[model samples]
Target: MQDEKLNPSDETPKPEAGGAEPEFDYIDAEELDRLKAERDEFRDKFMRALADAENSRKRSERDRREAEQYGGSRLARDLLPVHDNLRRALEAISDEQRAQSAALIEGVELTLRELHNVFGKHGITLISPQPGDQFDPQIHQAMFEAPVPGTVAGTVLQCMADGFMLHDRLLRPAQVGVSSNVG
Candidate 1:
């Protein structure tokens, strides 16, 4: 190529030729501030949404655990009648009759014991109320009230139907007779 020379008047533009440096066209201060604000707002909203989703998940897990823990409550309540019947049958046999046929009585006793074992295995428990014990409305249903001379009022005079519990919850309240100080 031939040697070429440029005039000073046609020289390339210098960095500071103008009084001010060339402004960057890529982003203006107003646009940058608006974009940053938008980004910050979106970030805050996303974090909040994520936290809400986590809370919802935790709530669902708690509900599921509660359901699993108490799922058999209804079935356990229904099984209470079977336990009652078994107890009643054992109670029906007199001591004299039991002594007369020890083998037969033993067989009945064994069967009753097995039934109770099954109940315990499934978290079923008997609520045997004692005479003179304070009656509790939560676990005792008063069938009748009678005056029993020296007994305190609201004392359990008799348990007509035994109560039962499945876990800590009452499956059935005891049908009971209370004693009062009046005629």
Candidate 2:
């Protein structure tokens, strides 16, 4: 119930009863500089580590976005043959034959058009080159080269199979025949 005074021996060191201030722990200039240098080095290291972590996070985000954008490339490529076969089936039917089976032809043509629309929505584009168009190696794969009269060298003689692009990337190259100049 009563307050007790603490003994001097129990107290931490302080200035004596003399008017002179106790010599505070005198740190030398060299020690102060060393401590400052150590602090600066640790601060620099911490900043570098922080920057590295930020950069890693940004890279991961970019990679995730790219994966989302291009994740269907493999499946799209695999389904290309189906598209080609469908086109060929329509092409194989003569006009008279198509007229004879008007409903069947209409259904197939509608389905093909729907498929193309789906591809367009997903950023799939064709690279079909007509005859005599200039050949571009970037989007065309030359299946054969032949000498043709009055045709420019490196001109696309024919496109056997059309190419496709998924966004800016090439999904497939157009199968083509190139022409060479002949006398």
Candidate 3:
């Protein structure tokens, strides 16, 4: 019997139903790409939400600090009238009466001193402009400008109303007359 020669293409390839072509479930490449993209998008959205929550927390903390700093603003404003009343009482009492009634004057003076001490403790400061002091627009409001021959121009001639400061911030500006050059 002659030996039968086998051609390379004459061999029948077995179907991949049994051997190791990695038994994988059929999945489309495009569909896989779409799924991966969706996962990435979800991850990005979660990160953004986390960042927003952190930012909101920081903002709330800042607001809380600001509230603490300015919490007594309304109360401070209301107490201003009490200060005004104290000043008025002192002014209303004449020097003759003060001399005649020493005990009454002393009591009034002591009360005024106590009030000022309380104001200082609460970070309230009086801004009383002395005559001939330089007029500062930031701290003083010019109610009127008048010519004064002796005093320098732009100097405070008189204070009509006392100003006040709460810490470093102006509570009220001093009302004053500014001196001008006399003709």
Candidate 4:
């Protein structure tokens, strides 16, 4: 039998079923620069978008913490007047009245104590400034200033209405009368 292989000049080749992609052998310098710029622009935009997403996530976490810390402030402030009324009721009772109505006084006292306990359980604290104590602007609001004997200026002469705080935030500032230097 004779050899059957054909020479390159004598035979045509058929294309493959799935053709391979063509390679870029030589690109123009200006075209290459334009392609690089487009790539860089897309990369910069992607990086900026990622940074913005990260910042938004961090901000939302901070906002959530603040909301949790100060969420109950409004309700706690509303309850302040009730606490004042209860305190006033207790203070209004004299020795004779207390003795005459021992059972009623006991009930009222118990209720007040229970309310205090509840406040304590919920991280609520009383900002009760006592006589001769230094007045603090952060937790005390000066309702009026007066000259009092044997007290320095800015001293808390009396706390008119007690303040309350929830956690680390002030729910209400204590209404107070402070001493002035003026005679």
What TM-score, computed on C-alpha atoms, does each candidate reach? 0.71, 0.83, 0.68, 0.79
Cα error of candidate 2 at position 107, Å? 1.3
lDDT, residue 149, model 4: 81
The top-ranked prediction according to lDDT is 2
For all candidates in order, the CA lDDT equals: 0.85, 0.92, 0.85, 0.89
What lDDT does candidate 4 reach at residue 27? 86
Writing each residue's lDDT as its tens digit, candidate 2 over 1-183 gives 789899988987666799566776989999999999999999999999999999999999999988987999999999899889888999899989987999998998998899899899888998999999989989999999999898989999988899999999999999999998753
Rank ordering of all candidates by TM-score, starting from the highest = 2, 4, 1, 3
Over the stretch 1-183, how does candidate 4's per-residue lDDT look in tens digits?
A: 999988889965555567754444788999999999999999999999999999999999999988887777788788888889999999999999999999999998999899899889878999999988989999999999988887899999988999988998888899999999654
Model 4 ranges off by over 4 Å: 1-22
Q: Give the alpha carbon lDDT tens digit for every residue of 36-135 in model 1.
A: 9999999999999999999999999999976775677898778777777867877898888878988987877788788788878877788889898999
> Least accurate stretch of 10 residues (summed lDDT) in model 3?
15-24
Best model per TM-score: 2
Give the C-alpha lDDT of model 2.
Answer: 0.92
Which residue pairs does candidate 2 place in steric collision? Answer: none
